[model samples]
Target chain A: MTKSKPLPSLIAVIDIGTHKTVGLVGQIIDGKARMLSFSERRTEGVVKGTVVDLEKLHNCVHEAVNDLERVAQRGIEEVYLTIAGPSVAGERVKGFVAVPAHDGKVTARDFNEAMLSAKRLEPPAGRATILYMRQPTMLDGKSVENPVGLQGKRLEVNFWRVTMEEGNVRFRVNMINAMSIHVRDFILASHAAACALISEAEKQGGVLVVDFGAGTTDWILYFKGHILCAGSIPVGGEHLTNDLSVALRISRDTAEDLKVRFGSALHRETDANQTIWKDGDKGVGDQQFNRGTITQVAALRFQETLEFVRKDVLHQLEQIFPGHAVKLDQNFLPSGAILTGGTANLADAAEASTNVLGLPTRVGIPQFEKEAYRKPEYAGVIGMMKAAIEDAPPPVRRPQGTLAWLKDMFRF
Target chain B: MNLFTRLRQFFSPRRDAFMGPADREWRQLIPQDVRRMPGDELGRKRAARSRLPLVLAVIFFATLGGIVWVSIDDTTAVVAGNGALRYKTDGFYPVPDLQRLVGQGKDGAAKDVAAIKADLEMDTQIASADVRRRGDGSLEIILRERKAVAKIASLPGSGPMVVRLVSPEGVQFSGAGYPSEAIRNLPEIIDYRTSGSGDKATIEGIEVAGPFLLAAQSAYPNLYREWSALSLRDCFGAQEDSPGSNLRVAVRRASQPADRPVLTEIVFSTANWRNELAILSRLDLDGLLRRPGITAPAYVLKLSIQNRTSARPVPEPRLVPATTR
Candidate 1:
């Protein structure tokens, strides 16, 4: 009889947002993701990335996972989830350790000791650290890419620590656990987006990634191939829709439709004379409004959101490198800012970002083999899968010996 | 609690205290990425509640499928073959012979696999038959045949005498497909009383002699090759441990003439035959017969008597003249 081939191992990820919850199941074969199945559902009981009603959110998340299982023909036991919103924040901390070797060579053990010392700093009250990103290592007094085999008396390292409120994280964990699925690890939304959209060259040249969701804006700053800072704000596309609804005396649904169809982030003088109908057909409920009015309302909200993010980035930079004369210009961030997420689909979004942040910007769409996955909204979930594969431990190779062979023979 | 009170409790937000400096100091020793958050008991309970219906449905359907499968007749679709019988055996029984022995009907109809298995096992020679129906609509069978240790002759009332083979278990059956030379080589049991006929026939004292012969045939082939016939006249059936109850085995003469006397018969007590057999296996009979002494044509070896001349009694075999027996 011929032996049957074994099936490849699959990885599953879920991105829970204020507007929608998405589930993806696929296999990472030879460092490339092969999509198997995907499902998404409208979110409820959540506002601005915070769980407000546990039962309603549980129903939404459970249905999405069930649909994915049906299509993939497999059940998901654990998943990598995305975390965002105002409760998430980052801080930079430094650690120092003295070299113990008589030859004064820095070993792997010294590097580990310095890392351990750096992580010893705790988050503020009622918050817990969720992730740690290592920066450059310093030997003696100079920064070195690798400290091993180098001579140094004192070893120091800097780590960008990310923390979140305990109560908020618990709410998310409880919601997912209610569906009989475990949360394996939490990936920050901005970090996941950067992994999907930012290339190695872009990271090496310094870049900023801003993910504009429906209810929140998360951004991460990468300088010299290391994460300098990351933060989130409680303002997104929904705020713009709310602004248009109040300004034009229309319902929220009609306002959203108008914002998607005729809205622009940069209003032009010629748009003042142009008129557009709410509904394409001249039906009884259809109404006409000046095209300029739609652009004006959307631009105000979009620019204010970008300004807030820019101000936050500058403040964090000042805190990290005080009196270093840092600036958000081409000299520091050579690759400029890359915009992504669902809200980034707005017309002239990059233009608005450049006008406000004073840096050249462009919208980034996640590139994938499947055309359906190459959209702004899929960047977070796709990036989450990539992060999970990159963070997984390497496969262990067994030693070939008589004892090992005997153990294998009797394994069954 | 009242509905209002329960509603108030459920909606109330829970505030957790921050970790102290001591706890943080110890936690920092471990890598932050590998650390996991505390478990949620209430969430786990909710998950168990959600999985209950799915688990129950799977179990119910599995049990129902098993019952339906067992209720159906498995042999209704047996593939066409020679008498619709397929079997393997280590003995000399052929396919057609086994089919005839199982009594397959002349009418071409599928028979129950269980019934076929039972019919095959009914024969005295077959120890067991493993019957199964393959997925391709064929009946598969494996048979383990019993080994014959000795032969016997019985004369029913006014009928001709018939020879039958005896198994190690003392069961007698017509040895089918056995070579004539192999059958002739087996020693015959003479002067024994039997109570039954056909495959169920029972010898009066075979229980004591069958295993003794089998043990010698397996462990001491050189000595067993000299045996020609066995006599059970002195053995008492059911009361084998009585005083002086013994079995006599007649030995055949050798083809070549020897200077020493030849063994005529070996006698053993029924109660102590196992110990006597062990002692007999260790004795150098040929060497003893060729020792310097008076010569005789034939002699009888008696191993059932004990030598009591010493303080401790020891059982030993003694040689006597054939005329004394």
Candidate 2:
């Protein structure tokens, strides 16, 4: 904030997930995010989205970022990050201000006053607000797109605020800072993923975005074209793997393999007597597991995770629209629910989401010019890149003097 | 929804929580500097790191090669005296002398230049000289001449009054080789300044007189040129640290035998010639000479013991007519 830097063309994004840390380089060319370099490494010492061991996470980050920088032939100084931890939460806050202009026309100053007033509304103790998305503005109790140059006695602004635990944010920040890089901003992994997968039309209508990461499930509700509610559930694909291990008497690693190999959420829809281990995928474990049993163990845990996400989102929505049967309203999610993230690739993940939420559901994958970008796993990083550009300040054009103009013209 | 699943979800520890030592190993071994130089952390590592040794090798050899080339190469220099290669002192330093010394080969060029400088500086005409060799294979020899600051005027009835030039360093030489006009313009050293014919040697007591003449001539050249001669009788305040001896100076008109000389004598006990000469130069000698009833061929202008000027015309014999009155 104390200095001005030249605008950079290459955008670097780091997505630290529970199982994998991804670093990618891209540039906005012709209104498309074109991937330049991409790198991925197994994340270490991170549980869910929280980095418990700073050093392990730092190495994981360094390996991925270093490889990307090597391939790009340039160093990265500043980057945007997508973080998902149990500390993520959201709140709806509002503020109002009287017009200061003599003619009662609203100005930027009035809008800023309202915004500051709303943000200063006490956040939870030991927590800091990281992001805020503005809702529709009200000019003298009348909703308007732009209050500027409009006659209004008072102006009010609403914000959906995202706050994170101070200690966890610091841990994530230090992991990146130790590598001598600057964190331009921290975005929630779900928001970033949703930004990538959700279309503009889907966002404008009501929709639900669920990013199923390895250790955490992040869900955000978009109602009336605004981010109405968002929450992070401390349960994800890893929990289902653990359940499968405990129920089937298998190692956690073997459980993960089983979950990836044969786990399906729509277990009841498949043949219950189908044998899971008949193909002899491994020579060491000679036990046969019925397809129904694999589904029964994994689906139970995955179903529980979906239930938690649904319950938390409903609770937040009820707080917003009190005394109103919000779910009963037919236009709750016109675009339905869109799922993404590492766990979103799980078999029958959409079916489980649809059965629980009672809405049309589909797995989301971010599409870009590079084929590597069009996958659920890449949704967070690509979306973070898109969001970072949107939040960047416009480039400054310095007025050139006569001498500078001549020098520029004659430069070889 | 059983108690087992609830407890497991509540107390699930992050994976690899016990691998602190392993993480430390990676932290220590990671190549922190993988980029190049002259850029940010990444840029510097990328640009400067991998080929650093190769770049250093190139720089080291380049410097060593330049030094070796300069040490072995033969540099020519122009040898000159004053502003030109030829000097007023003819045959002072010819090209053969330069070629014989510095042109032998590329070796010992510094020694050759020093020898040439010492040889030219030994000439009486040259006060100091410099011999330098340049980087472009050339040599330069510059000479400085000691200007004639004082003149020895021959006494009257001394065979047409020949003039002699005294160097600023107090060496007196016959003015036969110099133009008369230049010799005539110098401040004169009159009585007590003498030399045997063809001696070409300086008169004694010039050490004190030489600097005084030089400083006076430089400061008051216009006035110094008008004077016929500065009588050097008893100058230097006697010999051998003799204090309290009076030094008498008489400045005479320039030589134009048709006109009688304007005579003025100043006596001083100190060699404060600068102040004394400045005061003397300001006196209107021509105005004083043309004053009414002043028809004497010589006069004495004494600087009083207190350093003041007072004049007296020389006494003339009265003529008596041998006739019956």
- lDDT (tens digit, per residue) of candidate 2 on A1-412: 6665345476789988888888888755544566778998998988866767876776678778778877776566667887676877788988889897888988887887888777667666666567777777888777787788899898888888877776666666655666665566777787788888887788888889998888899888876666778888988888888888898888899888888888887678554768767348757756788778888887778788888888888888789879976781237788999888877788988998888877888999887777756889788888888777776642233454686556644543
Q: Against the true structure, what is model 2's DockQ?
A: 0.02
Residue A267, candidate 2: Cα error in Å is: 1.1
lDDT of 2 by residue, B113-132 (tens): 77777765555555677666
**Each model's RMSD to truth, in Å?**
11.5, 14.8
**Candidate 2: segments with Cα more than 4 A from true spot:** A1-8, A27-33, A100-104, A278-285, A328-330, A394-412, B1-325
Best by TM-score: 1
**Each candidate's clash count:** 0, 24
lDDT of 1 by residue, B1-325 (tens): 2344335546767423222222332122121221122134444444454466688889999999987784454633322364254566777555666666555555766657788778888888788988787665656677888887788887768879988888878898778888888788788888898887678878888888888889889988877777877788888875668888888888887632476788888998888888898898899888877777747878789998889999986887988778853
At residue B310, give the lDDT of candidate 1: 100
Mind listing the fnat for each candidate?
Answer: 0.03, 0.00
lDDT (Cα atoms) of all candidates against the true structure: 0.80, 0.68
TM-score of chain B of each: 0.69, 0.49
Model 2: per-residue Cα lDDT at residue A39: 93
Interface RMSD of each: 16.4, 20.6
Clashing pairs in 1: none
